[model samples]
Target: MPKFSRRRFRQAKTAPHRGFPPAAARSAAAFAALTLSACAVGPDFVPPPAPASAGYGKIGASTESAAAAGGASQRFAHGRDVPGEWWKLFHSKQISSLVAEAVANHPDIGAAEAALRQARETIEANSATFLPQATLGDSYTRQQVTTAQFGSLASSSSSSSSSTSSSSSSASTFVYGLHNANVSVSFSPDVFGKSWRTLESDTAAAEQKRFQLEATYLALTANVVTAAITDASYASQIKVTRDLIAAYRTQLDLLEKRFELGAVSQADVLSERAQLAQAQATLPPLEKARAQNRNLLMAYLGRFPNADKGEAVDLSGLRLPGELPVSLPSTLVRQRPDILASENQLHQASAEIGVATANMLPQFTLSATGGAQATNFTSLFSPQTMVYTLAAEASAKAFDAGSLFHTREAKVAAFEQAEAQYRSTVISAFQNVADSLQAVKHDAGTLRAQVAAEKAAAESLEIARAQYRAGSTTYSIVLNAEQTLLNARLARVRAQAARFADTAALLQSLGGGWWNRIDETPASQAKPTDIIATSPIAAAIRAQAEDARDGR
Candidate 1:
């Protein structure tokens, strides 16, 4: 062995025992840790109590129950409100079509749907905490280096000369390449229930979004129905105004004859003309309002506001069912989508308090990883080249100067704020139902009075025509009777429209006709509510709706 220099020499380190921690062993450790914290460090979640029955005002008995009592069970009974297809109660095909379009295409509704999708994706991402995360990777690298030492070694002479040559020799070049490929798996066991808490919070937030979607739908339908009713009313008023203009024109013609006969002053003719002008002016605003309402309906259908393609729905043609299909003391507040959404918000706030509280205690996580590495590509798959790591970490905010405490306190305040907001929403719903009920009743009475006045005016106009024909009354009396009849007819139209408007408002205040169904739709038959309630958290709230209906 005369000090021979080998062409190549390599050293490799292998961890033959390297692999993921034993599943049973790691599982046992995690179970032991979590079992010790059976009562999580944070405040355990407690759902907000259901809205109390007290303080709700009297708003007439529900007519929906009367309809149900008639042995109609195919549809929702008195307390059988469901979520999807709630608008079907209106029994208007146009309404159904418009709602379908809105759900599919309305920008706001589309945004809400996108938000729901993102929430589902977020749920999937968060689920990684409970499952292992895996990664597969490959790397390649090349590099060049200058080596003056190699150049000097080739020119070796005397030892001293060789040493000097090593210092002064031109640089030499070296090149090499490396490739590495590996697949790794990692996990951090949820020993402290932090992941569970996060899941709970996210679940609540997703539910809040769902209920918000429902609220938006409810509001949109309300706007559409109300606008349609208002438009019909204006159409009726326009007709009345046009008829009044005709009556005024006839009166003015007669008044001009009276002036030529020296029976009435020219002032009387001018007065008649002015009355005709007033009637003409009244028609414009009513026509404008009617057109505006049509535009609104188009907009609700997700079309251009001034779209001229569709036939305007006549309010008179729409017969609101004689009875409503809702309950008394109006669960409207409890069932309203906005209110339900707010309740979900309160829950999220409650869960957040738990999260912030958990931060006060030490958090423990059991982590594990497994992979393989080797300089030789062929050895990469060998057990000798495999690598594994198992670790347990304990962390805490050691010195945050009471930041955790303050955060927890802030979450507590937020929960209280949400609670107050929920209560306020309930109160507002009650007011709406009460006001709408009163409106319905008063509008009904007013319509009756208007009909009576119309009859009286018609009779008076007939008497005036007879008296003028007999030359016993001045033309002015005929003109006055015509004006009176015109006012009464327009008043009747206004009253009728008012009745429908109030009825629609009542329906809106009572959370429409769909809040009474108890059964949740399955995935196959799943509608909007089903899709929204897909999450366990949203399902829980929907279940609450059924429970409350059952007086639970």
Candidate 2:
């Protein structure tokens, strides 16, 4: 037989015997009933409206950030879509690699992924409530019975004869083995859509988990990038401080020679020595910060502090992104993970209201059992020994002291609470964007100012040193110039790093481009393991998790 025809034949042969009507007729009745009662109780969920504001901040705000060295003037292209791998915009291979590693190995990302999988599985388990449940079992029992128990004794009997009969009957007690087998099926129809409402709530919860997973991914990548930036900043600042110390030492030597030749006073030599000591003292703290940042980066990569495999990043290797994508306020709520997660919570709460409402209504269950019994195991399936039963049950709360009503009211309140939280999330998402935008703008101006100050200070120090060497100016003048120049260089390095970090912040605030991600699975049925190896990022994490599980 053809495959299609064979499947139809099998379905027909095993069709349920509902004992009331044909399966087709029962199905039609069920469909009609469902159509008539299709409306779910409680308020349907509607997404919160987007904010009315046009821009993240004041209207007509400048879109172009201030210009600084290294072409740090970033232009915000409104409505531009962000890429999934926003860190690549900095053009730093080391940072890109670190972020990739962090995404793959971070335990927090693994936890979030597991949570999303768990939620999906819960939804699957809950959905089974809509289907009929069946069970099968077999049993054998040995039992004994007495004829006297049935009152079969004659009334006109002598005591000795009756006692003799009773003794013989007790000695010959009837014992037999019985065998039984049965199949039972039960189903609770979703007449009021309670089961469906529960399923909906579970689906919404899974969606919330998916968004949380996305948020975790975003946070992990952002932290990795920021940590790399900080590490580079500290490295550059340490080098700058060390070089300034060397220059101070050289100036101290020149002062000592001049003091020996009576060309400068001993006080000048002591001042230069003190400045050199101050410059050297700055090294330990910067080194400490660098060490801390390295350890942090190692942690982000899911490794121990002593097991740092990450390469060092330098500020010179990073290029500031020229164009920045700024999502509109209207779209921010939809794109941000936290906002979307909150929306799912509101949806789950809405479904909970329906579930609670259904709980207050009547519930119906239909069940059927068929079996065979016999005194001997060989005759268990005989037609004469067959038995069957069919039943229907319904229950409703006639009076619950208003508990059901109050419970439903509580669900409504929870729904309202979720709605408020969703609104708050949207508002906070927009505020984050605003703060990042302002930081990017102001940090650019700060960098530009620092660059100018560093330049002027460098020129002043060079001129002062030349005058001191030519015996035309006091050593004090050169010492002050060197101190000013060192401070200026350190400030410049900070400003440069701030520009990069804030640019990353702006991208993160704009939702981290989750929409651009290619590895997203269907939220309802996907498991963390199903997609854990689907992308490079997830693959890395899965490999680490496996290694950890094996105690490698």
Candidate 3:
């Protein structure tokens, strides 16, 4: 309910000293009266309240995730603010470097930055509407006019006088050079807040763009982290598969010797050979996936598919964060960029309603022009040649086939639509956070079970090999044990990778610490390492980026 100042019209110094006519003076007084009485008309915008739910999960439920290898139990620290560089929590050098590279060189980030700049400029342009406009002009023309065109009486009198004087007279054209100069001033006061509403709409639009830029930053960093984790996961899987193939080939060798010695049937060797081929088949797909993941990482770094990336990563090097930050439901609405952007759109829609309503009322415009005119350029500014005029206009549409009324109705509908969209965005944001929280929790339990299964399979495989060597167990038993062990190992690797990826997802869902950033310009210009060097949380990773650059 803030009151805005009215834009007052003032006469320019170049205006003629004679001032305005009586009618113009009366109109000016009326305009001033309207300006003082007018107010911005429409429903003022108010932000939607946060959802009534207190917790992301069932009431009184624990927010801690189960413990597993490569990560400890992760607890959601409610009301804790996220760090500016949330990726540093992983403590991985390769991930930090990749994210920094993407932020600096990605085309999408640049485009978003440019869009924000454009929106800011538009707001600035719209602000100028509150100022009066003045223009100065000068012109010279040479023209001729016939005496008869002035009046029939003047023509007839001149002709009669010529006849009486015994001289013939003709309607002659008079030609002269006329010069004129003038300065004009005009202003349309926002008596009903129409111009102010327009400015408000533009300002809100700029705010929306600013939030979108932050969203872009958050998305880009999260994607880079996810891609790096994928690259590491695929590499680990491929290596484990190749090792399994080697074990199978060795087992086949022993089976073949036993068959030659008449201790085993030929069928056993054939069966072992088939298993070895199957295990070998698994390698090609893993290799293909690993290659594809590498290319994707390069793309995320804004490089070509075959570009030289100096270092590689696997699950072995990346550490899962033990602590996670979670904002309160009320804070989530403020922290999330998409939600904030939606709220700004709602604000703009509310302002539009005011603009539409103002259009249906009377509009006031005041203008003045003063200048000099003379037949000779030297006499243009003389007192006798001076001329001036002033005017004011008030206009209101008497009838327009209900167009203005319908337009206001449309604006009201748009405001309602924006409000609905804002609510939807808030609901979706909360859903994202809830989903990530559950994934992190279950991923840990899966990893713990997979680890135990892998250990038991290894023990079983060792016993089966010993029993077969002593001629106490069939080759089929050893084959089954070997296959189980291989499956367990692959599952363990995938589980470890999942833990890392889900941790990153949790950070993204919580808005990626955009609030910690002071301004948008820094992310676009400064390197991630440089920006986070002063933070204790990022000190270790900052060293890693520096070391990588130094070929350490």
Q: What is the TM-score of each candidate against the true structure?
A: 0.76, 0.83, 0.83
Candidate models: Cα lDDT each: 0.60, 0.73, 0.72
For candidate 1, the per-residue lDDT at 183 reads 61
Give the true-structure RMSD of model 2. Answer: 11.4
Candidate 3 lDDT at 126 equals 57
lDDT of 1 by residue, 1-552 (tens): 011111111111111111212342244332332333234333333344445564335444432211211111111124434334554554667666665665555676667666766766675566456555677777767768777656556556545776675657667688866556666665555544555456557766876776666566667767776776677678778877887787678778887887899977786688678778877887888888778778877787778865557555565555555554444454555566777678778767766766666667677666565666665677778888777777778887879988988887787778778877877877787777667766765566677678778889999999997887677977678778878888898888877767666766766776654344332211112233343333332333344334434555
RMSD values for the candidates in order, in angstroms, are 13.5, 11.4, 11.5
Q: What is the lDDT of residue 209 in candidate 2?
A: 83
| lDDT of the structure predicted as candidate 1 | 0.60
Clashing pairs in 1: 64-324, 64-325, 80-516, 80-517, 81-515, 81-516, 81-517, 82-517
Give one digit per residue, the lDDT tens place, for model 2 in 262-309. Answer: 988888889988999989999999999999999988999999998976
- Return model 1's CA RMSD, one decimal: 13.5
Which lDDT value does model 2 have at 313? Answer: 83
Q: Pick the winner on TM-score between candidates 1 and 2.
A: 2
Model 1 TM-score is 0.76
Model 3 CA deviation exceeding 4 Å by range: 1-38, 59-69, 148-151, 155-168, 308-310, 518-520, 523-552
Which stretches of model 1 miss by more than 4 angstroms? 1-105, 140-181, 330-334, 382-384, 464-481, 515-552
